[model samples]
Target: MSDSNTPDPNTSGAPVPPRPPLPDSGATGHPAPSTPGQAESGTPQPGNGWFAHAPQTAQHPQAAQHPQTAGHHAAGASFSAQPTDTHASRTTDAKVGSGKIVAVLVAAAIVGAVSGLGGAAIGNDMFAANGTSVVSQGSTTVTVNDPDTVNQTTGIAAKTLPSVVTISATSSSGGGTGSGVVLSSDGYVVTNTHVVTLDGASSDVALRVTTSDGKVYDATVVGTDPIYDLAVIKLTDATGLTPITFADSSKLNVGDTTVAVGAPLGLSNTVTTGIVSALNRSIQIASSAVPDSGEQQQDQGQNGESPFQFDFGQGQQGGSSSSGTISIAVIQTDAAINPGNSGGALVDDKGDLIGINVAIATAGGGSSSSSEAGSIGVGFSIPANIVKRVTDEIIADGSATHGLLGAMVGNAADAQDSDIAGALISDVTSGGAAAQAGLKSGDVVTEFDGVPVRDATDLTAQVRALAAGAKASLVYVRDGKTLSADVTLGELTE
Candidate 1:
């Protein structure tokens, strides 16, 4: 319900000694981070490797590390066998309803909705009817010719696996595993910013992507929307890639089937299944560390290295920081998301893209360490509709725009004697859209654009999901009377 949103595991909680940097193979796994200013444990960390599961020592690795780990891992024999898993999948049939209010890290739900991309959104033809796309103009994107009907869970998994990828990001700081979805032919991939940037640990990241076909390729970040926790990266000289089919998430209903595909715990080609637990669920969390210049640094990694942070060396970093808090809307599902599943795909029964996996709701709260972060049948994703809008803008313009209500608002529940759940307009910017529409302080917004407005979080998430200059209808309460009005939204500038 708050910022306790547990970002999917950076580590599977399996504590293995850090492996040495393999040539052309990304940064080797490093032992889990110890307490502040302490040596990392090379010995196995008992009973903490994964969330309610055993670590696949052969596949899972301690992802994301601090820079001070320069000398932590010894270079010698391999840490574990580097076997490739092409068609690996196991079912974890768990489900949770959207009404379940569980404590979770809120990173995934922070970004609610956004609708622009304007001229840039023109190429949605790339994702054609029934999840098929025409040949991309400048690159080769292989699609499943008349893919099999996905009536069952296995069918969904099989249809979508090839389009999901296991991303290994390493930096001089450390390295860890996450997930991504193929967006275009020219090797454009959509993933969580935390995955490539290791939860904003470092800006300098080198990425190594392993597709479901067990093919590995190097990639670079095309752009990132940290406020939304979404990022687009492009593969280098990539071809024959199977593009994912897009589903209209706004048309989805509760109880529809969902299948999540990713590399959870660093296990590649992993799949889990669930249903659409809820919609328009808004969340807020601390903002990611973005460069003041608002520009993404190009790949500065050396050949055969990852952009993830693994402190195999002793290089130390001081206290880290981010910008501030951000609000977002998300899709809630129970498809067993894990630490490494960030930026992966959460598809529907037709194997169509619906949402991109991000964070999970855990029961308890403590430190930021994901060593024990596991899904409690409550996970969050960026809805495909929003993902499409933000990614399209990022690919075309290197950033995305969000709608502004031009009003300062708060949760109505905070008002004494208030008996409703909605967003209370505390102040309206003069000459702003809301003010021009006659909205004033003390008005409680109950609905926006036909969607229910539960609170300020919900209102903000809803407004930000649309394009600036977009027009919308809203119902609000004033002086015990209900009123409706049409208002054009404004642009949110950072």
Candidate 2:
């Protein structure tokens, strides 16, 4: 189910407010471009935002933003819940044959042949007709092999099903169902933060996890990183449980076999198979946040705020002005991940967990209404590498930290217009990592560590992949000369 606040794609009856000009950077002399695809004049140009050459007056419908909340509830009811039909019946017929007549006939023939020898044989035929007869019986045995063979889909499912669990979240307002992956034998399970939070609020929500073996246990939220759309939960009294093996997501390639195991539409232990469609995909989804104590305010940024100012196209519609939402990097897959599949396992051919199945794109678009939809071959999963890093920190410290570059970067089109092929730095935070590395506002970041920074989004994703406080080598263009710098990353703070 998509987020209730997501906008519908078919209707264009309402006019969107005109976007404001990009914020001016003081002392830097460079203003951020308005749209990633066009210049400051708002003219249509070839770029990444939406329409690659749409007229300034032309208003294109926004792409539907699906939140991938599989267990979304509506007004105290489950959106994916349905009445289950369990009554089934079968009929069989049996056939019987009479052997008495056959036995009597055989005795009569023997007696007739023996009658020539003795009259006593004739009396035996009459006795056989009135006496009990011998019956013949046959038996046959069949052997069936187990279907869960190694290297097959069934094998993957069998190996991973024990670690994949169904999650149920309820509140006084409503309840819903999703899925989770066991991260530890002592009850640590990883899932989307939205799965347990109520309407993006962490308070007043109750969570429970049901294992594949039909065991249910109450769960407590250990910690959640809303920016990553990941949360860690602990199952009460859980021990000796099976945990999934995490594969190196960095080793995954396109066309590698992927198997998704989850409970779609409340169906437990369901498995779907496909191949890795793409990687390093950035998607925007709504996130819930609780206000600080005694804080009373409204109209926080619609797209929310990120420590590393990473902007991806237009902000998705459907979030309230006060509600916080953020974009996250994900692994794209053609696997049939659907509503109720959130927090499930996306495993590789060897049954090792590569990603956590999260949101799925749908054809119907997203709305604030109470309708639910299925996947359209475009599903996104949180890479297992990030999952491991974030969950480990949560398990130890009750919160997770992300690496930040402390610079406001421009989009790809801005770089192209500047005749550069890297991320353009429009502003650098005072005393931040970028400033400490001698990076000025006009400098264009070309490379970080060893990976090329193609655009602002690309740079943000790479920084997030690393741990805070790690050292990184950066190459940038200042004036007409290129320079390199070694700097320590900064930690993101809320």
Q: Which candidate leads the pack in lDDT?
A: 1
Candidate 1 lDDT over 389-484, as tens digits, reads 888888888887777778878778778989988988878889988998999999999999888887877787788778789899999999999999
Give the TM-score (vs. native) of candidate 2.
0.63
How well is each residue in 294-348 modelled by candidate 2, as lDDT tens digits? 1111111113232211101111221122254454567777777766677778876
Position 335, candidate 1: lDDT: 69
Worst 10 residues of 1 by lDDT: 71-80
Write down the TM-score of every candidate: 0.65, 0.63
The local lDDT score (0 to 100) that residue 257 gets in candidate 2 is: 62
Q: Rate the local accuracy (lDDT) of all candidates.
A: 0.56, 0.55
